[model samples]
Target: MLLNNKEHLNVSEYVDLNLELRNLDLEEKKKLIWPVSKSVDALMNFWNSEPVRSRQGYNDKSECSQLCLGQLCPALYTIMSDGLKPHLGSTFGPIANSVWQVVEASSQQGPLTKTLNDLVQKINGEDFITEGMLKFHAFVFGLLNLRALDAWFAYLCTRESILRKHYNDSSVLTRGRPDEPRPPLPRYPLIE
Candidate 1:
């Protein structure tokens, strides 16, 4: 689990990283300069390995949180990832991507820009990066697909921590989608 602020100063690191992202506005961010689509395809491919039944929540389960965090959430994510069947993929893609976008924008819980407005000065923080992932990993990624969204929420909560740690914060949200080619919501997490 990622240590709390006690582990190190979080502000400074966030400042550095914010600079990198802020340099690029929403339109730029949408470009996917890093070629995110291919990586997304790979992740979807992995989820496609299982059948919808297997990819769906366990028959013997209740409580959305438990069902979601447990097996149900993962199942739907996988099933949705399976190539868009005309009756399935095509119908769901737009809805799914839009829902994700809403979650991405709303999850912030606040204005992130204001929070990190003076990033450079915030560098007064003193902290070191530890080796390992944060505790919210499964809860976050498993709950939502690891997209710019993953980065958005993480950045919102622990801007400094994410910047200090190595690895792409693809979890953050970005703008400019391809006509919102995601599936409808009832299929993803809300249903199961």
Candidate 2:
């Protein structure tokens, strides 16, 4: 099913599917084996496609220019045309999309599964929106208890979501002067 730029799911229907998925054992979940085969098929294509380079209507200020995906429509997305969405981009997208397709394909799944899959992939693989990139998807899974994160984290547990450790420039503040010591500031706010 085609998903609108903005879409939603029925929580009631999804709850049942969640139970079905819950019934699956570790081995089954590892293989991404869900009752919904069609959903898996569609998700394969969704993860590979890139973000909308140009919106259907011709407008530079359209979603094409916004940094984020349409989630923050009027907020103006700073993401590059080729850049990935934060949080769920490169890594999380494919993983998240896999789960989305499963949930959506179920009898209890929602119609917006396709849209959710695409958006999740965009957030993970393309932009690398994990906490490292200061994206919301990172916290979405961490802070919130959305059922969506299940498949993503499941994938993480099975295949092993690998994080390459690379030492780069320090984000810590550097002393401008080599010899001069930095002045100490009060840790607490001063009373008026």
Candidate 3:
């Protein structure tokens, strides 16, 4: 949760981090190869762990597991340390180490990121962590799988079309005449 704190990381720190990533060694980049594979394995495990059966019978797809913030923090910590940290070296060491500490604290003391007031309002505080874990799993899965990218691109295209249509309609409504025809849509290279 401390990792989520705005005060701990300023704009300059982010800029420095991005610079470090770009300057990272090729050898360090090679180290990241295994983590990418490991992430897929982790995602498969999470997918398998999801309950599939309903009261009546099995379903084609199951809803994602509940958030387990406790489990999620450690899982993310593992992903960062085992998957990303080895490749980052001294560049992201401080941030990685800080995240490790947060993982440890969250595991032992419950959700460290939530405010005291937020925790007090919960009847079963552990459930909150559970929800966080589910969201974390989904996020990680999305990152590891390019399907999310495809979905995002689809969304962008749909939004662009909607906006373009709106703009054309508005222009006609305001001018009392159809505006000059829109330019031909730009063609983008197709990904095989």
Minimal lDDT window, size 10, model 1: 129-138
Q: Each prediction's TM-score against the native?
A: 0.21, 0.18, 0.21
Q: lDDT by residue for model 1 over 13-129, one digit each (tens)?
A: 545545655566544544433334544444455456555356555442333344334543344333222222222124445233322222233333446443222221132131431
**RMSD of every prediction:** 23.2, 24.1, 20.2
Instruction: List model 3 lDDT by residue over 42-159, tens digit each.
Output: 5466557645453356443342232222343344434333322222234545333333232223323335324322322342244643443343444434433434423432332334
Error of 3 at 143 (Å): 6.6
Residue-wise C-alpha lDDT for candidate 2, range 75-142, written one tens digit per residue: 11111111121223355343332222222222122463444455445555645544332433332333
Ten-residue region with minimum lDDT total, candidate 2: 164-173
Rank by lDDT, descending? 3, 1, 2
Q: In candidate 1, residue 120 scores what lDDT?
A: 18
Top model number, lDDT:
3
Candidate 2 structure, TM-score to reference: 0.18
TM-score of model 1 relative to the true fold? 0.21
At residue 149, candidate 2 shows an lDDT of: 44
Give the range of the ten consecutive residues with the poorest summed lDDT in model 3.
Answer: 168-177
